[model samples]
Target: MTPEQNRHAAQLAFVASGAELNIGTPEECPLPVDQLVATRGDEPYVRERFSAGLTAHVYRIHAQGQDWTLKLAREKCKVQNVDGQTSFLNEIQRRADLRHLKHDPLLTDRLSAIVDTRYASFRHGVLLSPWIEGVAIQAWDERQLLQLFDTLVALLLGGLFEWDLCTGNTLDDGQVRLFDFGYMYRFDPLRAFNSNGTAMPQFHAAERFETRQYFAHLLRLEQDGERLALDAFTLEKRIAVEAYQGLRAELASRGAAPVVLDWLDGIIATWKRALVNDVSELYLQEAWRSHWLDLHDDLSGQTCTPSTLARIGWLERTARERYADVQRLVVVESKNRLFDQLREARQLAQRWQVA
Candidate 1:
């Protein structure tokens, strides 16, 4: 079966399996199943209540001499899409795969950045793991970037494609860690670009990270000055270039399809050439793509937040001030038309502020 068919089968099996899909042993649970279901923020053991999530109610609960994150699925998910609706199940499924990957000695250290699943039950809509005592990455330093890309490379080589790498999904205690897997899916790394196979080659791991998270960081830097933003972009691109080179080498050794190897080679060559000469053009092109695509994702989910409006603002500003550059990169025939469309998008984004 194809990857999509396999995904469908897995989703169906998860929905039907109920308690049979539970991870970890019963002795590993922080609380009894019945008592855990009864828990809410007000409970004394519940240390923190994070109710902002669209798919689940998350809480930091103190139990069994430790704090653990307890996630309970919402009765109705707010994103209004199939992926959003099934995200909890997806998380559970990925956790099962990740658990095995964690046990691999070669990857034990590199994959430690991924959070471990202690207990999960599809029927009860509950997932639990040790609480991460970490803060959101305020800035992307070299250490954070290297660690994140290392983890990402390991994940990709292991056949997992993580679509969502947003700020909320990553944390930094002493090391960068990915704690969310709702949008992560399985694929054949040697044969496919991502879970969708070779059909969507444009949506690679680095592109996902830049679109969902890093470009937003660069956008903030842009407001400071173009020079600062360019410097940061160059730094990120250099790291990405190195990571992709290593990834390509490893994939080739593993007998990855020529199509996959060639795709990686193309990306590497383009970035390498841009790095040697001027990175400004490439920066403008990718920044525009990332912001526009991320905005589309937010609008599609009907889950627009302040960031969505900020992106529209950037689009309008770029259309007015950098029309020539954007046109050079993305084939815009009419600047006025682009600005008008952005204005309309801004209004719609304003109207759909769910966060």
Candidate 2:
């Protein structure tokens, strides 16, 4: 771990070292701390059980006349990485940071989409928040895009970067809501482009959303027609361009580093030029990037699903049928080499599907 990561890990270690670390007041909980810690989703208060999360078991419970989400960390995290092992702790840390950010007058309203943490205890391996009645979004519209980007801009300026914007992490009940913080990390808003700082400019807020969620939507749209996918891409890009503009302006006003501002400018210019000219090429480029990167992530985590194999299929088909176009995008390996590599990846993905 880097020095920053070491320090962050130390903090989490302290919280988990039987210090009985508690974020919110114990009085705020509807149930006793002991009962909440020992819950297994079979209690009378449990209204719904969600065991699909990789790092935690979630239960919707009714207590004190209101519903709340209770998340308990898995004894063994499904994801095969350090990040997975500490995700529950990371979430508690983010919740504390979010609680502080929400208190800011300028961000109070802009961050309405973020869920409030009712309570969290690292040693107990439990987290609590108000149960959101929102459902997962099936489709993205202008309203959803705007609301999400607006919130993303606020989070970026506030020094929090969310990496996993997958379909499961978001909800829509008239307004889009972000209810998970396991994958969110903190960085310097004025000096860093993302959680990794300026070292990895490829990964940003818009790219994270596109790579983890929107491209999956586009993949479905492609079954209908390329036109549908392209249209959706254009809409997302237009919104992203606008959002990046706002992010750049705000960062500049805060006296952000020149390199950071320049990075944003380059991304904005590329998207604007694509919007004005041929967007098809840009669509292909980003689709390829998103799929390849997401596939790498899934494979690295050993958490591959049917979706991972689907991405492999796309990469295979694109490499075989559109080798020339792919080459134009600066693929270094030969088509045959890419095929061999993806074939191995497909086998690995097939073997790693979680039950």
User: Lowest summed lDDT over 10 consecutive residues: which window, candidate 2?
Assistant: 3-12
TM-score (all chains, Cα) for each model: 0.95, 0.96
Best by TM-score: 2
lDDT of 1 by residue, 1-355 (tens): 8667677776866676664568986677978977787787899999999978889999999998999999999998888777888888899989999999988886788899999899998778889999999999968988899999999999998899999999899999999999989999988899999999998888998899999999899889888899998998899889999999989999999999999999999999999999999999999899888999999898888888888888888888888889888987886659778777788878888888985
Candidate 1, which segments miss by more than 4 Å at Cα? Answer: 1-20
Each model's Cα RMSD: 1.8, 1.6
Per-candidate Cα lDDT values, in order, are 0.89, 0.89
Candidate 2 global CA lDDT score: 0.89
Candidate 2 error regions (>4 Å): 1-20
